[model samples]
Target chain A: MEIIKIENLSKSYSSLKRKNNVLALDNVSLSVERGKIFGLLGQNGAGKTTLVKILLGLTHPTEGRFSLFGDSTNNYKNKKRIGYLPENHRFPNFLTAYQVLYYLGLLSELNYDGLKRKIFEALELVGLKGVEKKKVKTFSKGMMQRLGIAQAIIHNPDLIFLDEPTDGIDPIGRKEIRDILVRLKNENKTIFLNSHILSEVELITDNVAILHQGKLIKQGSISDLTAIENEYRITTDSELDTFLSKSDFVNFQLKKLNGFTYVLSGTDEDGLNKFVDLLRLNGITIKELIKQKLSLEEIFISLIKDLDKVK
Target chain B: MRNIFIIILYTLRELFARKLFIAFGIISTLAIGIIWMILANGSVMINQFGNANPGYDEMEKIVLGFEVSAILFLSDLFILIAIFSCANLISSMLEKGTIDVFLSKPISRTQLLVGKYLGGVTFVFINMTYLVVGIFLVVSFYFNLWSFTVLLAIPVITFTFALLNIFLIISGLLTRGSALGMIVTYFYFIVLSPILAARDSISNFISSDILKQFLDFLYYLLPQVHDIVKTVFKQILLQNENVQYELLIYSTIFLIAGLAISFFIFEKKDL
Candidate 1:
């Protein structure tokens, strides 16, 4: 089921003397499915943040329409099911982590007992249980990001929009955040993760959308996009220089590495088998044959470059 | 109703947590102490003057004048405080992005704006109440004056008028800076209103009836801080027989106009 459907949405800003219009979202339309980790990847100024803000109703679109949970942006009931973590995620400096969640819970109209339980659970989930009483101003950047995530999920929202969830986090903290997102996915919650961190997105996201210059260039399951043709890297102790020189392998452009290793890429499995057999017949002992799968970052960069070339 | 309560609670929490209430308390205490000392010294000086003079009941008259002046001065000071305290309350929230988090909830913009306005007004009311009590205790204990209820009404009305006027003008506009907004408001209240009120006094030297009439019209166009101060002085100190019904009517008009202006501006504000 499509949880969010944005159709041809656009926005621009105006100023004196000149109407400088930023095509923040240029007729962009996309849908997020239910119970999936949907990654929204984009470079800076690619309208990722603008799209998130539009979905959250922080800014009205200049044109087009969007619906959340099958209801239009003006629908209040739809908003209750959606939670948001802004890019910077600044809370009132005076509020502690616990108070922030409790306040949000109250705003969401949670009952007293439910609010208390949710606040405690959320703080614990985000590793903020022991420091719940510390003012938000005293928190480090990573802690603030965690608290932002905790507040976004305090009410157990069905759909959460997280913008730059791990922007400034260290490697271990980023891993922890990825783990939390994975746990949320296991609970069957829909998450829209917006970030430029391709590796982190690749680790946790089930599906991905790449946005470029205020437009979505490519989007699909990670498996589908990163599924390259069968390529093998063979490292062998036996010398097959004569076999490689005598055969059509040279014409096929087989790459030689370190005098004993050979790398070949082909679309057909039979071609790979024949190549392996020829190496074996030539008295070459293969120590390891490893298949190279494309990483999401590589695919993302390639896709964006392809889009740029086309444009 | 539940949503309103939640908003109110959040606003109150924010206000107290920011130490505004404590700051207001300390400032109020200092102001009342200074005014009380000045009035007491003035009264003593007036009594000494009357003792040295012959055939003049200057002590009673000077005491009455001192009472009137003290109440007037306190009322004006309270109004100034109210304006300065709540002027940037909403604009600052918007600028800081705190308002966006609240807006992302199911709450409407109107509810958020009204909640914030009420919270600020409530803060002003509480501070005014404290000021009133302090003035009462100081005046009654130190001067042997017992006009408690009468003196309290001046601060209450002046504070309300101050908040209403500010809410009318500042609630919906996109002000460039808080200091600029504050300076404009202060100048309008202190300099503009007084200059407009003294049209007749200036007209005597210039000998121009048209300019005097124009100034009279201008005086009626804006809020008259002096009139409010004078009304409070008459009701509290002079024990005047007739209440200033016209001034009360004019204050009500200003209050309604302010509310209407605030509503119109807030409705059109982008967010």
Candidate 2:
């Protein structure tokens, strides 16, 4: 199901004295599906957070339309089924972790009587089980992030929006949060995650979208966005150096590590196969070969640079 | 109802856990202790308890007067602390990014703001209960006299402060900085509220009818919180029969209008 759909959305900020309008989101649009872990990527000030804020009704769009679960974005009731963990989110240091979740859960429409077990389960899921009563001020940054996630998922909404869920988290904590997200996804919950940690998003997102200057620059399955179609990384025994020096068959080595292996990328299968055949003709031992794609970070950087050129 | 109540609780929890609440607690205790010291002296206790010198008057009335004096004096101090405490309620929430968590919930923006406003008053309410009631009990015990009228000032002073709180919350939302919010609120409190309260007296001195008319207009329009505070305290003391209706009316107007505007702006704001 199309859980979220946005069309031609735009948001601009202006100050009366400035006399110039700052365009934050410019005619951007996208869709999210139910039960899919969708990742949103952008550099700072690219309107990634702005778009989320609009959908969450934290801000209104200047011009556009959006709907969630076939309901208008302005539908108040739809908010009950959604949860958000804002970027750099904070809770009062004075409250115990449990108090924070209990209050937020109540705000999410869960009764305290019914929410205790859920809060415990969530804290446990976030690796914060026994520390429920610890004051939030005493919690480290990573623990706070985990608690933030716990609050976001406390009510077990149909869709959850997590902004920088793993920010300031340790590697182990990041892995733990990833596991929690995976577990949520396995329960058929849709997750809309935004993060600067590309590797983390790359690991779990079903689909990825890149936003640049309030514009939707790229959106697709991670495989498709980062995929080098029909490209192959051929690992051979010590022939890359000579191949580069001799240069037969139009040289298509993406990278050559230690003069043996080459990440051979080509636009089409024909080009890839041609390079492979030439490597075999060189009589260099073919140790192994496998198809590969660019990392999400690589694709993200390239897409941003490409967008920069057009601007 | 549940959502708004929870948000209110959420806000109250934050304020209680903060250091300012603790600071207020210590200050209230110390102030009460000082008041106790003054009451321990028999002469000051009997003579200075009431506005008039202690006489063969009923102990209840004299004790009531003393308690009323303490309530009024502490209220002045409380207002300062309350303003400092509440000045950051909305401004800091938005700036520190905690407001987003609440905004994303199923609750309305107005609900959040009102909840926060009430939550701020909740802190004031709790502290006043401790500070005001404690002072009342001590004076009654020390002087061997009991009076219920002094207790009435609790709610009266609180609502009056709530009326003043409107300015603080509005300034918080518009300015988005704690110091700036407090400065603006204090400006309204110090300058505008006072000017509006003495509008008639000042008007009599003005030579021009136009300036006097402007003063009268400003007096009615601006939230004369000081007027509300003073009149309510006087009413509690039973010293004034001419109750100032503007205290209730103007305070209510300022609260509703300031709250309405703050909510409207916050709802449309991008957090």
Candidate 3:
């Protein structure tokens, strides 16, 4: 089931004195499904956070429509099932970790009887079980981020929105949070995350949408977005540098990566098969022939660079 | 309702942790201690004043007069300190981005704002009650005269602060800082409201009727803080036979209208 649906959502910010308004989101639309991790990728000020805020009702869309859990109205009851950890979020500095979670849990309308256990469980999941009594002012940035996450999931929300959840976290903590998100997804919860860490998003997200300057430029599953067409990284037992120097290789584009590995590109699968046949006939035993793929960061940078060049 | 109550508790906890609440508590204790010391030395006080053998009625009047002065002084001080301390209740949340967590909750924007408004009012009320009741208890114990009239200052003073708090909250929302709210609220209470309340005497020197009418309009439009405090004082001294209950009613209406304005601003705010 579609957990969140937004269509033609746009947001513009204007000051009375400023003649030109800032378009934060322009005709953005996307949906998150149940039990999947959907990542929103963007550079700073690319309207990723604006979109999340609009969906969570922290801000209203200037134009278009959105629905949460199939209900489009401004019913606050939908928020009970949703959790959000905003970028740069802060809990009351004087509150202990436990107190912060307890209060936020109560705000989510959790019964007081079970809130204590849930707080503990959330703390443990975020690896903050021991410092539940320490005031937030004394916590490190990473610790505060953990407490933020704990509060986000303390009520066991069905849909969680985390903007830069792994921000300020160490590599180990990031991995732990990624595991927690996966576990939540396993329990059939939807996760909508906005992140600048492309590698982390590439690793855990089932699908991703990239925004550029208030516009969505690319969006799809990781494999689909990164898959290079009609390209293969072929590894062989025999050297290809000397062989390619002598062979007629006009049927495809080939670049020798090293001793026995070459990047082979062609117009179609037939062209790829012809190159494979030529390699077999030459007694070059094929060891690996895998489709080439780009890293998410590479695609993101290229897309952004390409757009910048067009402007 | 549950969410609003939780925010209130959260706000109270925040006030406690900030140590301002404790600071007010300590000040109240000292004030109460001073009152006790003064009332306990009634004979010595009268002797020092050259009235060594005062009758029971004279002593009671003197003590009640002293008590009234102290209560008024403390009440004024309470309103000032309360306004200063509660000014940042909402602005700090916005500055630190903690309001996003609140606005994302299952509560409406109106509920969140009301919770914050009440939380600040409750914080001031608790401190005012502590100080006022402490003074009343000490004075009543010394004189063996139970005057319930002075206890009424708690709600009256708190109500006055509650009305001013709307200005603070609105300013906090608009400016995203406490300084503007603090300055505006203090300016209104200490300068503008008092000047407008005494406009009738000032009007004699002014020739322009339009300016006087504008002043009168302001007096009627604003929360009648000066007038309400004056009426409460008269009632406490038992000098007011015809209590201006209309002042309280007007202030109450201003409070509701101010709250509605706050809700309107907050509901449409992007954050």
Candidate 4:
């Protein structure tokens, strides 16, 4: 079942000094299925945060409609089911870690015993078990981020929107957060993961959506979009500088290091054979040859760069 | 109703955790101490003044000093506390992004506004209760003019005025800068109303009686300075003089109107 559906959504802001109408989200449409971790990948100023805010009903869209669990954005019932952790999350500084979660539990309408158990469970889940009484003001950056996650999941929400969940976290903390997200996802929770960290998204997200310049440029299952054909790079020992001058391959680029390496992109068997034969005929012995697929980061950067060039 | 209780609890917990509550407590204590000292000293001076008259009633003299001192101290303390406590109530929360977390919940904007307003009012109640008790002891035990009804009504009136003023300031704070909103509110209640009430005859040379009456009307529209202190003064010192029902009605109206405006503004605010 489609848990979230946004149709033709747009958002803009206005002010006196300048009518700065930022097209934060531009007629964007998408839907997420139940029990799938959907990654929203974007660079800075790419409308990812805006779309999340609109879905959470923090900010109203200029046009179009969105619904959560088949209920409209304005519906309170839908809001009750959704949990959101905003970017650079900040809690009331004076509240202790336990107090923050307890407050959220109250807002979520949990009973006293239920709230207490849930708060403990959430704090333990986020690895903040013993310091529940510590004030949020004295917490470090990573601890604050964990507290943000704890509050977001305190009600055991069915759908969670985590914006840059590991933005400021160190590698160890980041791994812990990733583990928590995977655990939640395995429990059949629908998670909307928004971040510029492509690798983190690539690890846990079942599907991915790439947003660029306030528009959804591409979106599909991780395999569908990033599955490029296997390609080989062959580096020769001798200085075959003449290969750069000849344009035998259509989608091939060559570079000379200690020798020469021809990097071919397509998976044409005949073309590979012909190129190998030609290199042998030139008396160039291949030193190293490796076949590899493009990483998600490489694909993401190339796609966004291409989009930038188009604009 | 559950949401209201939750919000109130949340707000109270958050407020108590902050340093401002501690500061308010210390300030209220010092204020009560000051009031105690003045009443003690003023009673001595009043006795001296009565010594010359020879026929002056001792009870009447002591009651007059207690009434004057309690009225002045209560009004000033309540106004100061109201201004300082609520100056950044809404704007500071909005700035710190705590408001966003609350907004994302199932609670309505109006409930959040009311919760915050009542939270500040609760703090005022606690502070005023201490002051009321302190004043009651000094007036009744020292000056021999304390009444139970006056003790109860003094804090109630002060708290009512504080709520009205805090809500009004919060209404403005939601839309504009906190400092600017607070300054505008303080000037209107503290300076403008009193200046208009005095009606200085010199103003008659340049303005008509209609304009003067209009100014008086505006002054009355405000929560009066005297009303805040009258409960303690009337019962403790003025003997059986009761607080006017009309002032209570006016206070209720102001409190309701102030909260209504705050709710309206907060609903539209982009926090």
Candidate 5:
């Protein structure tokens, strides 16, 4: 089921210094399904934050519409089921970690009795159990980020919006965060994550959307987006040229490397079968043959670079 | 309603965390102790039977004037502190990426605004109550004079503070710069408020009818807190007085209007 639906959403900012309206989000539209980790990948100022703001009702759209959990952004009750952990978040410094959680949870409308254990559990979940009495001001950047996650999940909302969640976190902490996210997913929760960490998104996202310059360039399942077409890298004990020499294999155009392997692209399934059969006929043992796929980072950089060149 | 209380609680926690609440309590206690010591010393001197200390009635009149003005000054100091402390109430929240966590909640902008606002007011009220009650008790017990004037002054000062809070909250929402907020709040309290407070005197000094008309309009528009202070003291000392209901009514309207405008602007704010 579609948990979030946005139709041609746009946001513009106007100021005295710049008379021209700054288009933050330009006619963007997409939908996120329930029980999936949906990643919105974009660079800074790519309108990822702007789109999140509109969805969260922090700002109004100049045009188009969006709905969360079957309710329009205009209906504020939808927010009751949503949680957000914004980038570079800071809690009130004077409050102890426990007090910070208690106060924010109270705003989330969680009663004290209900939030009491949840608060401690969240702290422990985030690896901050023993330091609950310490003031937030004394926390390190990574600890603050963990506390941010704790507050975000403290109310146990069905949908969570995390913007640059792993920023400032160490590798181990990032792994812990990923584990917690997977657990949340297992419980049928939907996560709408906005991040520029392509590798992180590549690791966990079931569905991915790439946004650039306030426009969405691509959206699909991660596998489909990164799938390489008609391309395979094969490793064998004997090179392909040793079998064909200068014969009818001239049209094959195979690229050889390290005297034992070859990369082949633009070959159909039948051609692949014929090539494998030809190798077997020659008594060359095939070590490995695998389809080559682009990494999200590679795809993302090339996409933006290509768009820049096109303009 | 529950949300409002929650916000208020959050505000108190924020203040307490900053240690400002503790500072307020400690300072107020010290001030009360000093007054008690001074008055008790005077009592000791008079009880020695040959000292030059004034009698009970004279001491009462003298204390009425000195203590009243001193309390007024202390109240003014608290108002200034409240303005400085609470000035960033809205702007700070709207800043530092912290606003996102709040805006995504199931609460309205009005709730956040009112919650932070009332939090500052409640903090100030607690300190004010402590100071006012302590002074009342110290003066009555030591000098053998109990004046209800100090008690009556709490509401008047508090209502006057309500009027200033509008400016504080507005500055918090409108100007993201703390220095700018401070400047705007103090400008109103020091120059505009006093000008409006003594509008009648300023009008008499002005020769031009048009200028006098402008002064009159401003006087009626702004809160006449000076009038509140003067009347409260005069009534306490049983002096001849002219009490005007218009000051209280107009100040209340000003407070309500300022708060309403702040809530409206904040509700539509982008972040």
Candidate 6:
């Protein structure tokens, strides 16, 4: 089921000193499916925050329509099922971690009867079990981030929006948060993750969308986005140097690497087969041949650099 | 309703955490203590004024005058303090990104703003009541003047504060900072309102009818805080039934319009 559906969403901010409205989100459209971790990848000023704000009703959309839980109105009822952990989020400094969760949980309309238990559960889930009594002012960045996550999930919301969830978190804490997010996904809850942390998103997200300059340039399953077309990495027991010296292989391009490893690029799958056959014909014993794919970080950097070039 | 209540509680907690609530409480207690000490020696103080044995009516009048003076002074002090303390009520939430959390909850922007506004009013009301009722009891016990009319100042002062707080809230929302709101509120309360209240007398010196009409417009357009306090003082001291209901109605309308404007701006504003 589509937990969130946004169509032609655009937002522009007006300023007294500027001649033109600053476009924050430009004709962006996307949907989040239930029981999946959907990652929204963007650089700074890419309107990632604006998109989240619009969904959470923190701001009005200048154009387009969006629905939450299949309701186009985006009323308060839909918010009951939605949870948001905004970047740089702050709770009242004087409030203890327990109090922060309790307050937000009450705002979420959770009854006081079992709220204490929920607070404890959420704290423990975020690895903040015993520190619930400590005031937020004394908490470190990681602890505050954990508390933020605890507050976001204290109501057991069906759809959670986490912006830069691992920001300011140590690697170990980041891994723990990833674990909690995966656990939530396993519970059939949809998670819409807005993050610049490509490696973190690469680890857990089922689907990813790349946004650049307020425009969604690419979006799809992670596998499809990262897979290199008609490319394979092959390792053989013998090098193909002698074969390369005599043959004019115009159908494919081959580059030899360290030892017997070679990167082969072809026009299609049939071309890959022909290359494999040609290598085998030359008595190059094939030890391994695997399809190649780019890391998410590499893909993100490449996409952003490509866009920058176009600009 | 529940969400608004929770936000109110949250706002109160913020005030308590900031120590402003405790500060207001302590100040009220000190005022009460001072008033008790003064009223306990009411007879001796009157004797020093050449009145050896004042009648009950004279004593009531003297005590009522003193009560009115003290309340007026204390209400001004409390309003100034309250304005400064609650100035950051909305702005801090925006600066720290807490308002986003509140807006994301199952509550409308109206509920969030109303809850915060009521929270500020409730803070000021609690302190005003403490000080006013304390003085009322002290005077009632010492002078035997059970004047129920004195209690009216509690709501009147609170109403004035509620109106000023609307300005603070509007400024806070506009700039996302407390300094400008605090300054504008203090300016309006201390300088602008008093000057505008004297428009009729000040108009005599002004030759231009347009300028005089502009002064009248400002007096009527803004909250008539000075006039309201004057009316309240007359009612408390003279037992006057000739109340200016129009002033209250106009101020109430301003309050409603201010709140509606805040909600409209906040709802559409990009956080």
TM-score of each: 0.80, 0.85, 0.93, 0.81, 0.90, 0.93
Model 6 agreement with the true structure over B1-271: per-residue lDDT tens digits? 7877887898899899889878988998899899888867876878876897888888777777888889998888899999999999989878747887877788888888899999999888888898999989987887777988888888899899999998989998899999999999999999999999888899999999999999988887889888888764566467668767788888898889988899887876778
Model 6, span A1-311: residue lDDT tens: 99999999999999899999999999999998999999999999999999999998888899999998889987877888989999999888899999999989998989999999999999999999899889889999999889889888889899999999999999999999999999999999999999998988999999999988899999999999999998888899987776555455666677887798888776578777777787778777899998889999999999899888988
Candidate 1: which stretches are off by over 4 Å?
Answer: A17-19, A229-293, A307-311, B1-19, B31-68, B138-155, B158-173, B196-226, B232-271
lDDT (Cα) of model 6: 0.88
Ranking by DockQ: 6, 3, 5, 2, 4, 1
Q: Please say which candidate is ahead in TM-score: 1 or 4.
A: 4
- Give the number of the best model, judged by lDDT: 6
Off by over 4 Å in 6: A236-255, A267-288, B48-51
Candidate 2 error regions (>4 Å): A16-19, A229-292, B30-61, B141-145, B235-241
Q: Fraction of the real A/B interface contacts present in each candidate?
A: 0.40, 0.84, 0.82, 0.48, 0.82, 0.87
Report the error of model 5 at residue A150, Å: 1.0
Best of the two (2, 6) by DockQ: 6
lDDT of 3 by residue, B1-271 (tens): 7777877887888788889789999999999998888767766876875788878777666666676778778878888998888899889867546888887779888888888889998998899889888998898887777767777777888888999999999998888899999999999999999899899999999999999999999988899998888755657566568777877888789999999888888888897
Model 2's alpha-carbon lDDT is 0.81
TM-score of chain A taken by itself, candidate 5:
0.94
Residue B219 lDDT in candidate 2: 71
Q: How much of the true contact map at the interface does candidate 3 reproduce, as a fraction?
A: 0.82
- DockQ (C-alpha) of model 1? 0.36
TM-score attained by model 1: 0.80
The runs of at least 3 residues in candidate 4 whose Cα sits more than 4 Å from the true structure, single-residue gaps closed, are A229-293, B18-21, B27-68, B143-146, B152-156, B163-177, B199-217, B220-251
The alpha-carbon root-mean-square deviation between model 1 and the true structure, to one decimal in Å, is 5.2
lDDT of 1 by residue, B1-271 (tens): 6666676677778778878788878877897788677766754665565564424334444544554555457657766776676666666567634655676677766576667666666766677677766766676566564654445554545454553445334633556246666777777777876676566677778767787778887667666656555554466455567766565566567766765566566555544
For model 3 chain A, the run of ten residues with the poorest summed lDDT: A242-251
Clash totals for all models, in order?
A: 0, 0, 0, 0, 0, 0
lDDT of model 2 at residue A93? 70
